[model samples]
Target: MLSGNTKFLQGVQIYLLSRDHSNLKSDFRHGNGKIMVNCIENQPAAELVLGKHVFLSVAEYYLRTKTG
Candidate 1:
C-alpha cells in the first residue's frame, strides 16, 4: 500500500479506488507477504470473496491472506 500512513494487510478490508487493477495486483505480488493492499473504490476488495457474483482477477487467490 502506497498510502500516506496506512499499512495494508491480508484479511483486512480495503476500499480500492483505482482503475489500475493490474498494477495493484503486480505490486502486491512483488512482495512476499510484505506489501499491503488498500482500496478506496466504491466497493470493498474483500467483498469479492464475501458476496455472490464475485469475480476475482488473475492471481487473486495467492494474494488472499486467508484460505478456506
Candidate 2:
C-alpha cells in the first residue's frame, strides 16, 4: 500500500544497506568498511539517492509494526 515515492525510497534504502554491509570480513574490520567508505566517497549522486530511501523504509516498518 505504499505510494510511489515511498516505494522508491524503500528501494534506495535497501540498496544502500546492501552496499554498506554486503561484504563482511573479520571482527576488527578490514575490506568491508573500506568498500562502503570508498563507495560513499566516489559516488555522491548515488549517495544522495540512497539517503532519501532510508527514512521511508523506517517509516514503513514503524507503521507496519504499530498496526500489527
Candidate 3:
C-alpha cells in the first residue's frame, strides 16, 4: 500500500516499447540515430483530434480504472 508520503516515480518513456524481441535493440536506435523521447501523460501530443490524442499512457489509464 502507498502511504501519503510515498512518492510515485516519474514514469519516463526512454525508448519505444515493442513486443518483438529482435527489434528490442533497434528500438533504442538505428546506426548513430537516437530516438530519445518521453510522452507526457494526459497532455495531447498535438491539437485535440476528436476524442483521443495521438498518444496516451496505457499504464496510467489502467491504473485509474482499477483505483476508481
Candidate 4:
C-alpha cells in the first residue's frame, strides 16, 4: 500500500471538484445506429473514465515521488 499523504488527497479533491456532469445523459444509446450491435456510445461516461485514469496516473507519480 502507498503511504497516506495530504497532497495526494488534495489533488484528487481538485480533480473531483472540476467535474460538471449536469449535461450528461443517464442512459445507454449506441452510435452509428443500434443495428451495429456494439457497446453504447457514451461520451460523458467515456470522458469521466478517461479523466479518472489520467488523474490516477498523475497521482501514482506523486506517490512514487520522494517529496510526496
- Which candidate should be chosen as best, given lDDT against the real structure? 2
What Cα-based lDDT does every candidate model obtain? 0.37, 0.38, 0.33, 0.33
lDDT score for residue 14 of model 4: 56
Better of 1 and 4 by lDDT: 1
lDDT of 4 by residue, 21-50 (tens): 331112112221111112223211122222
For model 2, the superposed segments whose C-alpha errors exceed 4 Å read 1-4, 21-68
Shift in Å, residue 65, candidate 2: 27
Indicate which candidate wins on TM-score.
1
Per-residue accuracy of model 2 over 23-47 as CA lDDT, tens digit each: 3223114532222322332333332
Tens-digit per-residue lDDT, 1-68, candidate 1: 22343333222423333336665445444643234333444423332321111224434444453453
**7-65: candidate 3 lDDT, tens digit per residue:** 21122222233334355335433623233333545422322221121123466456656
TM-score attained by model 1: 0.30
RMSD of each: 10.4, 9.5, 14.2, 14.7
Off by over 4 Å in 3: 1-9, 13-21, 31-33, 42-68
Candidate 1 segments exceeding 4 Å error = 1-15, 37-67
Task: Compute each candidate's TM-score over C-alphas.
Answer: 0.30, 0.28, 0.24, 0.28
